[model samples]
Target: MTERPVTQFGPDFPFAHDDWIRHPSGLGAIPTDSHGASVAVIGAGLSGLVAAYELMKLGLRPILFESGQLGGRLRSQPFEGADDVVAELGGMRFPVSGTGFYHYADLLGLETKPFPNPLTEAAGSTVIDLEGETFYAKSLGDLPSVFQEVAKAYDEALESGANYSALKQAIRTRDKARIKEIWNPIVQAWDERTFYDFVTSSPAFQRLSFRHREVFGQVGFGTGGWDSDFPNSMLEILRVNVTECDDRQRFFVGGVERLPQGLWRRAPDRMVHWPKGTSLQSLNGGALRPGASAIRRLPDGKVAVRDRWGREDVFDAVIATCQSWLLTTAIDTEESLFSQKLWMALDRTRYMQSSKTFVMVDRPFWKDVDPRTGRDAMSMTLTDRLTRGTYLFDNGPDRPGVICLTYSWMSDALKMLPLPVERRVELALSALEKIYPGLDIAGHVLGDPITVSWEDDPNFLGAFKGALPGHYRYNHRMYGHFMQENLPPSERGIFLAGDDISWTPAWAEGAVQTALNAVWGVMTHLGGRSHADNPGPGDAYPEWGPVALPD
Candidate 1:
């Protein structure tokens, strides 16, 4: 057996064991006294997988169900001609802000590479076209001539309530003139002639609203809000929190998926292995059975799930790590307060429609010119381009630079895009050349760009989940509100475990933190009074979380 790498955040790491004791819920003892039955984790995404793995450490057994491949969105593809030029489609490039995830990776022996931040693969000679004129704003001194005007406008725009239009539409309108007076100020902010002005209000801010002039208006920048925007000062704070004080911009030497792979590796044998590529036909009401424990309840009774081959099994309990859309379409129809409330909560929230484009080529196709020291090599692009995403890394010296392009596209185009595997690849490749000009496409286009537009998948329905301006602060959870309360007082059999439930949604870090919470709950429940008021564990390397969500 390979010697386990000296873990930076292992159990023996300083204050490791103490962290488990400090959680509000206790470090769980196995549930030998309570029920002594097995627990099942639904979905093999990062959270579900980690929770099951952690439970087994306390001597409780867990089963994981994955309708698709494990790793949720840690997607990878093998390039034919390039030497080890693998491409990642989704969930690539975790920042220094991934605090707990960093700890998890260190323990798993995964090596993280401090890759610089650039908006795309084309490093040098990159241009931002606006008003038919282009500018290259790579360095600090390269600020565009109109940067100051943009700065003031951007400040007003940000300070404005974020969704001023939506908030304006929902305000109390008892008085007509009063309503108009209230709205006039907000209208001036949102309709500064166009959303374009609102975004480009700042020179450094154009990309925040996806106003890059390279492509037509149909395309845009990374679709997420500025709350988690790259290059923001927020990342500096996040890096301090997620990583040790020494860490900075990094991409896992192998790939971003290695972070999850690392966390998965730290898990015991019981968790490292699971049933993969198995389809879940239906889940019966595990929670509603006669005298059944609370954890096992399904919506109506308990979910009775059938496999793709139509084999059926209704377990005593289930751990659902599903995204919002999955519950609406794939779940079996029984009925229960939990399921009804859960679906309703999801129904109330709005999710962004996304289209992801991953372009993997044969070699270091783009010319890299470093401006810091007048060198001709830099593996990052932070441009404000339409139809572009963050991250361009040296996939390997063999392939040079295998670029992964991600864009948050409109979800309504689920029909505008192709459904079949072959068609999907063709569409992605065509989209790639359209964004990057003068790149020899004759044979340079290796295979095809892999597109993962989650809006259509019956299993996930959409990407993990999204949070609007005030959504993060207003409500702890946009979709999973009911489950938050369903956890028993001091003892919860059913715990909400997933990346979507935490602050850093849609990443392995959030998922792992949720797992740590579940393990804490389980240990507390099994130990009875022995483990009371204990501060639970963290994502293995140990980032922090609120014991309870804000009301």
Candidate 2:
């Protein structure tokens, strides 16, 4: 037998979604009879929308049910009376490593610009404030000596704790065997450890003082302040860094929401049941149905979904893309529909709290050089203060700009939950005033500020899953749901797809990849098959599947 090619993602199992979709083998076709079969897709977010669109191409009729807005957490709130100026309440940045999600963005013809992450070229300059000491610099080299030490310590810790360089090279070369060898051991070692434990226990971090760890927590490498993630599993942090999820970030030009909306309206070259020019919009009569309230299995084995108004629809299969918490709260999911093991996985899933506040400025005033130091007056700020991290967006020198006054998580986010938009803005401004001393941030504000506390939102419950120590078994169960061929028929039809179900949560690529997994599951359930040359995940599972977790 010919030797099979090694999997792309190896033990980390990110799901080589971009590779699979664009492969010459193609996703394959369904039987002509299966073309018009209805499939219920809950939540019109990136995952649901992508799955529905791909299924439509494969001859399946996907009926999307969304309880909230179509974009779900990819929400872009426009400034009052100013359509162009907006705030991204969720999922603002996209990383280049998320090739799978970008495939859809490319197909949609959406433009992207580099996100202004701290110390990146797009940020121009960055300010680091800790314990009443403030430092401003154009790049990492310009920061204080202690900051450089923190960066070096972090690098050394990764190299020591996890053979960082070898893993990076393995990932870069797509050396699946080497990647599995390096990553599997790390997963075993770190799966039960918190990020704080990894940091404090590392030899490199131990050489430094407690202050070093505190600074590292306040202003983390790549992104800002990782104190929010200190309680999460070290395995989760390692996956993010090794995959380069925090690097080379970009943002959708208009809004991330455009990706899903564009897909909804896009007319593909060919579709299974619809005419040549048909789009999801046309199929649904320009609107998605109301949210799904209940899901159960029918007597004949079909999945029955009920809308908010008690309207019932039965389909051959169902793909739930909503947050897992909804299974108990908003939706009356049948207990028998899922195995107790699967139910435990869904119930144990933990979501992190996040909050963001944005204010529209008259223009990119931060571009102006300060007369005293010849530096941009207001650099993208990362501080231990109440604001945590502040980002500035430049539409142009003359056009309106947006400032994310506070992008915080966990306790920081919870503090702002009780406050209204105006009060939140006031706290952020007060914090910034202490940092700048003389800048008039309030004067340039164009309209009312926009804010979001993801925890307050009923549909989401929280921002995204932050796997706790000892949660690997739960994650393993959730991520493996798409591979249901071995599952009993009673547990087969209802599929799960979302960032929350992927190995790497909070990234859009996770959502896209899981959607593809569900697509494969639905196609197979409906008597469809991927082409022999281009086998789907089901065909490749035995050889290239997710890493097996120890019970």
Candidate 3:
């Protein structure tokens, strides 16, 4: 193992997994007699599961309420009759930089392989289609000179406008002070600007033709086309890049859903209220309570939650891990549960539309050498056509392979919102048919295709929050909710936890980090104190909290 550096956050501020289990969580233990104290946890996603697991270890009973499946956005759907073949409907790639999330993945013994990102080795080969032209490449060097120029311009802009290198170094070293110093300035400058504004405004891009910008929008670096994110806050894009959220990406071997499912049945080495063999699955008697329909604060300083089936339960505290909008739409929540300022933040949270259509093939035919060109039969594709990004997942030589025919966002996704799964698949194939003229893509398809339009799903109105320009104040209010020391007692117990509440919105690491924050908040609320040696998030919040919004 590499020597873990002791940073200002004590080797754990960013990840926190090591500190959580290495020593006694500095939380004051719950009273032995009060081990039966029950806490209501809204949503059974990664955030809620983690918070419940930790709280259970600390002797508090947690009753989970989930409107959807347990994994939340980590939806992994296996193809019919091919259990080994799965399509990741949401959150396919995960960066290794998300060490907090990796801690759980490692603990669960889940296997992962490098994701086939564009221009990466795992992709084998890449095909770029734009303006009635197609370019095939083994690497970026293989692309045309114009594409190379665009990539270079993007790098130059980041260095000149965002101090990319310095910021990366600060984050890599976990130097909170240095990170804040570098990040706060960029946030102030870019928070109110759109990503397109930053790119087009750059002198590097201006030196080239408008076509360069067009190609950059269709085949951006790290991931794929970023044109869909053009209207989002520049800060959102910068956060993803500087934090390495787009680098060294990997996907779970069987399914990304394993992380949350594993935690549901995992038995910690030590626990307070339950026995050594106790698991969340066993504690809940094998099923989660139905989705929460209503939540109200009782006069006795407790929380009352009613499920869709009208099953009501009262608890000393509540941890709502669902999307913010659900608090208003799906669940009838009391107005007093949150301050008006908080409600504004929650109501204004903007979720991006996303759609993905996938199909399973008999084999990884893309690996076959083409008799004519001596290249792979097919390559991971990026096109300005209707299909923006296409991914190929090779299960194995014998098992069926999965192909994400079309993965689009925003306007691109909304265009297919009303279409059926079959029609969506047809449209994607029609676009791809134009790119790979003679490739028998249809003949290779083995089973029915699966499709998802996140915006159409009531549980999650959209894929993830894409903060618009000038929305940092709202985000600041939401992210700072766990720090309720100054808030009234009525607002103290019902805490919020989810990726949307984090600075880096779409990543699982954000969910894990924010869940830890709620864990600390709940512990403190229950009169538990952090152990003197291993301080919780609240104990160390002032010294290493999120970068504050600049004036």
Taking every candidate in turn, the Cα RMSD to the unseen true structure, in Å, is 11.5, 2.9, 2.4
Tell me which of candidates 1 and 3 scores higher on TM-score: 3
Question: Per-residue alpha-carbon lDDT of model 1 for 254-311, expressed as tens digits?
Answer: 5556544444445333321223321111111211111111222444443455544555
- Segments in model 3 whose C-alpha atoms lie over 4 Å from true places: 1-18, 21-28, 547-551
> Which candidate number maximizes lDDT?
2
Candidate 1: segments with Cα more than 4 A from true spot = 1-26, 31-36, 81-84, 119-126, 147-249, 259-316, 337-340, 368-386, 411-416, 419-437, 441-443, 468-492, 525-534, 537-551
lDDT (tens digit, per residue) of candidate 2 on 1-551: 66322222534663466788887656878778877888999999999999999988887788999989988888888888876677999999988888888888998889999999999999999999887888998888998877899999999999999998888777766776787778887888888999999999989889999999999999988978788999999998988887788888899877889998898999887566678988877777789989999999888899899999999989999999999999989999999888898899999999999999999999999988889988889999999988999999998876899999999999999999999999999999999999898999999999788999999999999999999999988888888888887888888889999999988899898898889989999998887888887777777766656577768
- Model 1: how large is the Cα RMSD against the reference? 11.5
lDDT order of candidates, top first: 2, 3, 1
- Each candidate structure's TM-score, on Cα atoms with residue i matched to residue i, is 0.64, 0.97, 0.96
Error of 1 at 282 (Å): 25
For residues 431-518, could you state the per-residue lDDT of candidate 3 as single tens digits?
Answer: 9989988998989998789999999888999999999999888888887788888999778799999999887888998888788888
Candidate 2's TM-score:
0.97
Model 3 lDDT, residue 302, Cα: 93
Sort by TM-score, best first.
2, 3, 1
Model-by-model lDDT, in order?
0.45, 0.88, 0.86
